[model samples]
Target: MTASTAFGQAAATGTAPAFDAARALALAQETFDIEAAAVLGLKARTGAAFARAVEAMLAVTGRVVVMGMGKSGHIGRKVAATLASTGTAAMFVHPAEASHGDLGMIKPADLVLAISNGGESDEITAILPVLKRLGAPLVAMTGNAQSTLARHADIVLDSGVAKEACPLNLAPTASTTAQLALGDALAVALLDARGFRTEDFARSHPGGALGRKLLTHLRDVMRAGGAVPRVGADTPFTELMREMSAKGLGASAVVDGEGRVLGIFTDGDLRRLVEKGRDLRGLTAREVMHPNPRGVIRDDVLAVEAAELMEKHRINSVLVIDDQGRLCGAVSSNDLMRAKVI
Candidate 1:
């Protein structure tokens, strides 16, 4: 059968032709190459206009209102989110929705990032006058600089692509890629200008893995009070074993009379004791323990830091001490893993 006939039959019967793996791979690579070239082209275009956009956004007292339609609108939402997460206050406002009532969200002190590849989205252009009336500065990201949206824009960012990756050049493939990359460039520039740090990013993303790693403290995951496997320095070796077993921490802290940790007795220590054939029946915890064991103070140490400390020392657990050098708690690598901060 002819290729067109096969395609038609497949469309009608909901069955595709035998997949050509090589053709599929070639097309995918071509698409990637096209999009990559489009992004590379943007590097040279990053002149005064890009700098002006960043400055405008940085100077704004209010949020950035991102406006677009269809595929551009989808990209706008992501851009707004990136800006918001990276220290710039931003929100996506669909141009169509703005025409009805959402335009109220934009204020005079705010800046508007209008996206339209053709520079002629009716929904976006329809509200340019209203935005002007509100005194909101317009920053246009468009392909056609002479188009209506670009002509009226306070700052024009050229986001034109050589061509779409789509075979027919009908879809918003390369154009959308360029727009997205430009949006990211704006966000990263704003991020650097504001000196946005990982801690600040963690604050904005407390529910994610990065947040958990950076925000969660050692104290938050450490076992304290009765849960911590602690024993007196003079505690019998058998009693130390009981403490370790009872807490299920695989280790026990040998503390002094004042509740200050003096040493640590781990499963490895126990193994060494067995290998040495030491008579544990009458031994004290201090005799078999590793003195001045590695530990951290319960201050502002992050869980990820604690995990790193444990890994560096080749230990599974560490005693958590307070400013006064008293044993406050204990944390294990397992705790960090469980908290998803490792």
Candidate 2:
């Protein structure tokens, strides 16, 4: 590239005056070290106050009203979300907004979780009395134990850090990291106290992968009724192959007159038989099928469990049975993939 072109590119991107790769790497490592130490420091100072905060939140009949300002506000939002998803009802309310009208979001039965690094964010301090008067319990997470926010709080969690990762030490780096780690610790404790389970977490995150795995049932994703490729024990091998091809399930279940599963035959089985020069034309499904296939599942089974069964048995498809052991449906690895359950 020409000098003018390079200058133009640099000007367009608002490039810095100098680039020092080694210095940048060193500073990056220092930043990680500082932030990691800050979080570790919080672990050391955490005590009964943290337990009291979790107990207060667990006892709350109403949602946790998380209040903070600036960068603390961002951390508050994440904390609120984590709490809500993990069985604790919580929401973030910006301090400045609360001073105007959002204070109504808090109730007497609710709990307030106030976050401020210096413990004296003007927006937070300005409303401490109002929060107190509202009759809601308050838990403060702050770096300064003697600050106004901490002084007014019912429980104080010390998230203090010695220094920030910033070279100038003006930016909210280590302090904010400490606050975030403290918030996560609080959420984890509350969830454990509440007996929150994986299924409960999945309910709050139905759109995510874990939710799909836990919530999706075999019946929800299985090809049922006529969609299932099935044939009788007396069915000719050609007719069974036709059923498999027509349903495109890659396998066919051999059921009795009562619809109970007796055997299963797959394309793989047919291939092996063909390679063995076995005359399939005179064969019946019962004669050629693998009886009591191990990859059989119930309709009530979780889709993830079905995936596990298929993986464990090295099968591409599974036959689904009802409570009476009757063939109800079938599911393939491709079906699971389409449902995003695998």
**Residue-pair clashes per candidate:** 0, 0
lDDT of 1: 0.89
Local distance difference test scores for all models: 0.89, 0.90
How much does each candidate deviate from the true structure in C-alpha RMSD? 3.4, 5.1
Worst 10-residue lDDT window for candidate 2 reads 1-10
lDDT by residue for model 2 over 214-295, one digit each (tens)?
9999999999989999999999988988998999988999999999999999989989998999888999999999998998
- Tens-digit lDDT string for candidate 1 (1-342): 533334456667777668867656666877899999999999988899999999999999999999889999999999999999999999999999888999888899999999999989999889999988999899999999999999999999999999888755678999999999999999999999999999999999999999998899888898988999989988888888999999998999898899988898999999988999978899999899999887555645887887888888888888898888898888888888898987
TM-score of each: 0.92, 0.93
Clashing pairs in 1: none
Candidate 1 error regions (>4 Å): 1-18, 295-299
